[model samples]
Target: MHIKVKFLAYFRDLFQSREKIIALPEGARLRQLLGSLCDSAERHKAVFGKEESLSPHIVIMKNGVPVQNSGGLDAALENGDVIAIFPFIGGG
Candidate 1:
């Protein structure tokens, strides 16, 4: 299955692109997609914490809804799904 991932804010600079099309096997989950994207130690650390779970600073949305509302990293992904990645931002 192929999914589109959109990188925003700091992720854009880290990935060097605004978006990308990634190919994964059928039945892949969000965890697999994130592993594929974090191709390096630095990238991995940026996205995942020391325990190998998603960093609290990051936010992921699948098909316009926050992944947390679904199953988070265990969320099942489908072909043509649109995933957006960005850091959580705060304002005064």
Candidate 2:
């Protein structure tokens, strides 16, 4: 299956772009896709935290609606799903 992914902030550094079309296996979840896209331990650790958990500050949305209600990274993503990921940011 093919899915569209959009990254924001530092994530773009890892994938080299803010958006792309990726190939994923059937029944892949958001977490799986992210790990595949940013698999390197160092890279994952840099974009995410510990490479094992979704950083508390990371934001995920599907079709512009937050999937936080989907219990976070566990959110199931189907083909053609549009995922937007954002890192925490602050301006003072």
Candidate 3:
């Protein structure tokens, strides 16, 4: 399966691209896709916390819907699915 990942805001610089297409095995879950994206230790630490959970500072969406609404890291992924990642923005 192929997933289209979009990096927004500072994530574009962190990932070194605005977007990327990742190929994964059939039935891959969101967690696997996230693991693939973190190709280095620094990248891994940036996206995941000590417990391997997504950092609270980041937000992820699948096909325009927040991942949390779909099932989070365990969310099932299908071919052609689009995933968008961005830092959680806050304002006063």
Which is the leading candidate under TM-score?
A: 1
The parts of candidate 2 lying over 4 Å away from their true place are 90-92
Q: Write the per-residue lDDT of candidate 2 for residues 1-92, one digit (tens) a residue.
A: 88898988877886689898989998988888878877677667654655467767777788898877776778888899998888767799
Q: lDDT tens string, model 3, 1-92?
A: 89999999988888999999999999999999999899998788878976988888889999999887678889999999999999889799
lDDT of 1 by residue, 1-92 (tens): 99999999989999999999999999999999999999998889888976777788899999999987679889999999999999999799
| TM-score comparison, 1 vs 3, better candidate | 1
Clashing pairs in 3: none
Candidate 2 lDDT score at position 78: 86
Model 3 reaches what TM-score against the true structure? Answer: 0.92
Best by lDDT: 1
Better candidate by lDDT, 2 or 3: 3
Off by over 4 Å in 3: none
TM-score of 1: 0.94
Alpha carbon lDDT at 83, candidate 3: 98
Residue 69, candidate 2: Cα error in Å is 2.9
Clashes in model 2: which pairs? none
Which candidate, 2 or 3, would have the higher TM-score against the true structure? 3
- How good is model 2 by TM-score? 0.80
